[model samples]
Target: MALNNNRYSCPYICPSTHMQGEETKQQETAKIAVKPENILSAPYVPGNVRPRSPKVYPPGAPPKYLPQPTESTSGDILWMSPVGPWAAGHIDWSPQAGITGVRPVVDKYSITRYSTGEWRKNNQFTLTPRATDKAKALEAETQKDVANTFSNLDKKLNHSNEMLNDRIKELSYWKKQVQSTLNGITEELAAIEADRQRLKGACKILMLPEAISRECLELRTGRYEPDLVRDDAEQELIKEVAIVGEIRKIFNDTLIKAELQIEMIKSTKAAIERDWSDKEISLKIDNLNYTLTPDSNLILAHPGVTRWPENATTLEYWKHYCAESIRNCEDVRKMSAKLRADLMTSITKGGEDMKNQANRTNSALAETIDATEQMCEKLEDNLKDNLQKIADIENLIDYLKESLRNVQERNKCVMTRLHNRNYERPSVENCRDEAQYALMAEAKFIKESSESLQSKLREAESVRSELMKYRGELEKDIACKRKSLNIDKDRCARVRAHMPTPEEFAAG
Candidate 1:
């Protein structure tokens, strides 16, 4: 193997060199990935570095620190960048030095693309470096947003509390009003009870039934006595008068007829006596007819004689005297007989007629007397019946009047009982006063309760007003924050669109 060393030499590449080239490629890829981070960080322009307060811990506490990788190698690269502590800090895959190197590459490329007009002319994805003044402005904007959020929450809480309080006050006021109304109703009921009791007491005071009974009895006794007696007496007097009048008329008629019959008898007896006297004188003249003397003719020529003889001794004169005497005696006898027969007939007929008339009159009188007696008896009976009826009617009337009086008295007693509440026997007026006072007290209670409820209601209204004000303010703040957040989202979308995709530059 040592015969010719130069002629046996072999051509082979080094694996270390290939591996170093692959590392360079990987570094390039990593650098490209870090470019976006560098651009994101570059936009956060460094302002004046202010001293920040370190986190404080309690006694016996350990210091909080982020972890770091201990191993190191030549050309080693990190791909992930660390985030801030406030955002839950994570380790960066790329080293801090590598980020610095890639930052210039990313900036250069971004500038070239912008100049060539390959991106949007507005360069919305390009994160401009924030100046010191701009950083201050962002901090102020963040503080303002926090303050507005807190203020809105406070307003909402206050409005809810106010509404709750107002509702409680309204409930309390209504409760008082109800209590007052109940009190008034109680007073009215008490008044009604008092009135009822008074009326009951009054009804007991009047003893009307007994009085009515006594009055009725007295009226019954007196009602019929006088009127019935008077009517009976009047009827008796009328009957008596009628009977007396009829008897008087009959007696007068009988007396007139009897007197006329007696007068006719007396005239007939006188005419018979005159005829006998003339006959007696003529017979005496005939017995003295034979004696002739001068004085005889004178005697015959006397006024008592009928004629005077011319020859004093003539025989015809005597004969004529005897005949005349006989005729005169016969005529006297005939006249006497006629007078006797006529008188007897007149007396008998008159007596019979008178007796008949008397019997009839007596019978009629007896009948009239009997009728009068019957009338009297009937009048007496009628009087008794009328008296009884009148008594009954009067009794009824008296009973009614007494009953009316009793009712009135009872009513008066009821009134008295109603009034006098303090006394044993109360009057209507006294009862009414007690009832009225009770009612007044209840009314006062109601008024007071109502007033209290009204005051509470007013307070509730005031609280509600404050709550409404707070709600209005909260609504305004929320609206403003929402509008700001919308603007921020639009800006973020524009920036994201400007970012390049990995596949766009990858080798096929």
Candidate 2:
């Protein structure tokens, strides 16, 4: 009825459009507001409609999975990945040898300080061929080269030995020839030696016993060397023979004349023997003095012995006889000695050369042995290094193996987690519903809490205003009290100043 009554009274207002000014006022005056009897009551819904229950989960149901807030998974590892990471490994077996090894010498060998199985990590190490591998690779070439070198050394040694052996034989042959030539040229000396030997045999026993020989020499003379006793013994025996000759006389004239003649001949022979011995001794002495090649050649040219001319008288060759007999004798003795010395030097030269050759060969052999032994030691040390390297490599292998196992275990763990993520993810609709329900509950809680907080905030503002007023009043009161206290303090100061000390009061 009100709407009927107001319908004509109100100006036309566009129901879909907003009104302003007179139309807005007229619309307001003509408005038909339909309000229910109770503002909080529900509308008369049909009996067929059911009331909505509060959002609550069914009892004992699996909890909905709270969705992980999706990060920018397009570039992130929000989800577990099935793929395993690529792992790398390395081993350091290269030699880091210190000042450590064996050093062999002729009499003794020494070893440097040694350390073993010292392992360390390095990023710079790269793969290289093992020693055995490298050695195997070069085995044939090294063997061939070594064989060639050894063959050369052996050939040189063999050649040297052969030359040395042949040279020894040649020197022996030359020595024999030289000895034969010496014996042949020394005929006069040999004759003198024969006479001395004959006289020695006739005077005493053919060979004097060493004790008797020593007595005849060392006891009678100062000290006769056994080696030179033959000369001394001969002199003693000759004197003994002379004593016998003087004591023992023959009665027959013819026998006596023969005995005297025999004595004259023996004396003459003794004189000749004496002269020969002097010459021989002088020759021996001179033999030691010649040193130069020219001197030797001179000795060879002049055999140093010139026999006197048998038919020449001193009157026919006076100057030659007088000068040459004495001078030439001296010259002959010197020359003979020089010639013997030269012969001896020449004879031994070949032997000395052979000896030098042998010495050189031995030296080379020794050097080669030393070098070979050194190489052997080096090879052995290499082997030891290789052993250490292999042991360290084994440790490295174990380390890598452990690392690989760890990586595999980690991968398995990750893959297991990934598999669980794939299999165990909750339904998206259930999750979303649960989330929305939770959000609605949260929103209601926030609204209630916000209203409560706002009320509390208003109360706090009133309390703050009251506290500020009280604070202002307290500040004014404190200022008044401060001023009164200052006045009291001034009056107390005046009273204290007027009051005197006890001594001043007494004096006054």
For all predicted structures, in order, the TM-scores are 0.23, 0.19
> Per-prediction count of colliding residue pairs?
20, 1
Q: State residue 89's C-alpha deviation in candidate 1, in Å.
A: 99
Candidate 1 global CA lDDT score: 0.39
RMSD of each: 83.7, 84.6
Tens digit per residue, CA lDDT, model 1, 188-266: 3333233223222222211121232233222223422222222322333334334334433443443344344334334
Residue 450 lDDT in candidate 1: 50
Residue 276 Cα positional deviation in candidate 2, in Å, after optimal superposition: 21
Best by TM-score: 1
lDDT of 1 at 442: 54
lDDT of candidate 2 over 1-508, digit per residue (tens): 0122233331321111222343344434333221122112233344633555443334563323311111110101111122222111111111111211212111124331211111101111122234687788699889999999988987876676566555455434434443433343344344333333333332232112222223332332332222123342245434433433332221122223333433443443344344445445534443333232323544454564587767645544643443343343344334444443433332233224323432343344344335435544554555555555555555555555555555556556555554554456666623435545555555455455555555655555555555555555544544443333332233322322332222221121
What residue runs in model 1 are displaced by over 4 Å at the alpha carbon? 1-310, 313-320, 415-508
The stretch of ten residues in a row with the least summed lDDT in candidate 1 is 112-121
